[model samples]
Target: ANTVQVQVILDRSVPDRTALDIYSRPESGGDWTHHATAVLVSDGAEPGGARPSWPPRDADALDVDDVYEALTAAGLHYGPAFRGLRAAWRRGNELFAEVALPEDRHDEAGRFGIHPALLDAAVHLPAWAGLAEVPEGRNRLPFAWSGVRLHASGATHLRVHVVLGEAGSLSLQATDPSGTPVVSIDTLSARLVSSEQLKPAGRGVGDALFRVDWQPLELGPVNRESWAVLGDHGLAEALRGTGVSVSHYPDLTTLTGAVQAGEPTPDLIVLPITTHTGTEAGSGSQQAAQDPG
Candidate 1:
């Protein structure tokens, strides 16, 4: 874990006929290991080249609905903002996908070169092709992205081609509708994890969207004679907090008569009752019913 070595050896010197031989080893005292060797070849309009026929000739269409349903059942649900995959198909180890963000998300994609949601959707195509090497009760989550290159930006719609690899790893190339490269990853690996591990913590019901604004109730200009209240310290303090005049009445009958007569009658009345938790207060709605008028 402390060190890594990567050596590239050129197999050929010719400009168009160059080849690369890669050797890698860990710093933890390991022998030199040959990783990958590639021969650089000119890409033409052919299979396995830079440009290929759309959708591949023999790819089988996958059931997009079933893929989502299965993922949701595994607790891998994608919200509206992240659901970008439109359709997908597979041929052999190759996966093809069509992905498009909602029109409203175009501006965000423009600012951030192919929205991460869309990019993530593109990578998930292999999972839809049943390429995930996850064990039972387990799901695969993205672990790393290597050799990633963003060639262009401002693409809301994309076509993705993926080559599934061993152990839940894959390589993907994405392009805009015009066949301009949007992004490409030489290697994308996913880590196997239990569904429980992927489950997010429960969110508060009213974090920001639902909130209580505790504004002082506006009852009005003070009318000392117009306010009659009967309760313990709790009710007295509540009314006094609003800057309203509070007159304590000994009996409910006297309070009721004064309120119904409508002359020198208190416009607001309060009656306090003890709560189960030993608090000396009833809810605002309950006190509202105790108003004499």
Candidate 2:
């Protein structure tokens, strides 16, 4: 018999906190086995605890200047959106790193609540571990993550600790300048892949296949007669020539209506208009039409 079962539930009654219990059983209606427990925790490190210490004592420094270059060589671009490596150090199997967003993005730190770029930089130290001998040309990328926790929010500068875990995995912890814990990750894994696999697929933006349904907006009685001529312009055929397969609906009001009426709602809902009669060059209508939304 394929006998395996697991159940998890949140424990209520804990004020401002959450606890989860996971249970497993070999067979149905058999005794339930308590497999594990998960609890919410916080580090409570002050806002600026990281700034004062200045790269903990006795740790060998790792070159921070060539961080992005090394990553790009390994097929990881470390693109501008996620570039935040400032400095790094290593002591034994433990690694410490400093990461900060560019000066212009400082104001967006709080709004984003622990930006992905900073978090990526924090885990990026391990890739720098064996810089000189990281194979000839294999690319590496993050494979998995587990037990991730965000204790607090808004950190422009961060201190990250990466410790060796079982089976070559890494455990990561990130803190703010004052040493206040911001996030903890139980496990982070990376996989090396061939450089050929890292290349981008040769698909252009226009090559995308999308189901689009045309709907006419309510233009009121004034434009109703004029809008009738707009619908017969063979707009769907023109869209087909541009590589989009669209379904035309002459009388659909809203996207939701198609779903409720057992019709396949298209990936895109296009509302056509005859003309912009009273709109100025820089008006909201022109701006909205220009936007790719």
Count clashing pairs, candidate 2: 10
**CA lDDT, every model vs. true structure:** 0.71, 0.67
Off by over 4 Å in 1: 1-48, 131-133, 202-293
**Model 1 lDDT on a 0 to 1 scale:** 0.71
Error of 2 at 182 (Å): 0.5
How much is the lDDT of residue 26 in candidate 1? Answer: 56
Off by over 4 Å in 2: 1-54, 130-134, 166-168, 202-293
lDDT by residue for model 1 (151-193), tens: 7777888989999898888888888877878888889888777
What overall lDDT, based on C-alpha atoms, would model 2 receive against the true structure?
Answer: 0.67
lDDT at position 162, candidate 2: 82
Model 1: how far is 170 from its true place, Å? 0.7
* lDDT of each residue in 118-178, candidate 2, tens digit only: 7777877787564444576674557766677787787888888888765457888788887
Question: How much is 223 displaced in model 1, in angstroms?
Answer: 78
